[model samples]
Target: AADRVYLLAHGKVEKVGEGPYGAETVLEVLADGAYFGDQALVDGDATWSYTARAATACTVLVLTRQDVLNLAERAGSLRGHLDALASIPEQRTNKYGEAAIELSAGHVGEAVVPHTFVDYELSPREYELSVAQTVLKVHSRVADLY
Candidate 1:
């Protein structure tokens, strides 16, 4: 999954893969702010189909396909984040003022184009598996496991 999608926090990582007939290729070298696995995540696949290695000492933040699904089912926290995104108003502006203008005319044979309204994209996608990660911010009994 590392190759499929990760956000680099520091240092660097490389994506290596094999082509037809066992030919190896360096697919990409990614640094900070680079991300992949979006295609797989959007398309509903959890299996990582590539190999990832550290080009240097590195740190990364990852979101696996299953974790994305869990975030959807357990989206109470994400709602606030999304709601904040929704409150912003979108408009079209132009030279005079507005980009979209209304027009109406009467004639022997006049063709009218009706306006269709579209809504914002804020729906959750369905997934088959589940995933989660926990960052321990305390020195407690669970520290023993580490």
Candidate 2:
């Protein structure tokens, strides 16, 4: 029944204690699939003294102490799913932003139109092209010119 605990997603450990610091075992390292505060649940204690950080991109399923006990008592499927989730990395949800294109009067005269893959002139050897699609997704903020 502590306030905080930590889990390990990879095989690494970090220790924090009193060498030159205030003087206390502030932290203890754990391995992948290790539990930190099981004694509090078994003995009805209330206090925690450790925190955890992701060693790599990990899928952390956080639950309150009560929820942890409930899930631990549930069917084995929940535990299996937790194990599976622990083995995977967190995915990035990319957020696209609005972009503008600026060209000189003689560059984008009035007769030419640009597509998603339009190539823009540069130097004699370096030219850039657009690879982004023109279609906007649902609720996407799009700004562009013809």
Candidate 1, poorest ten consecutive residues by summed lDDT: 94-103
Residue 74's lDDT in candidate 2: 86
Q: Encode model 2's per-residue lDDT on 24-124: one tens digit a residue.
A: 55365655676555434333465544444444455443445567557756858766755564555433332322243332233343544343333344655
- Model 1 spans > 4 angstroms off: 1-4, 19-21, 73-146
lDDT of each: 0.63, 0.48
Minimal lDDT window, size 10, model 2: 137-146
RMSD of 1: 22.3
Q: Which residue ranges in model 2 land beyond 4 Å of their true spot? A: 1-6, 11-15, 19-27, 51-57, 71-146
TM-score of each: 0.41, 0.31
- lDDT score of model 1? 0.63
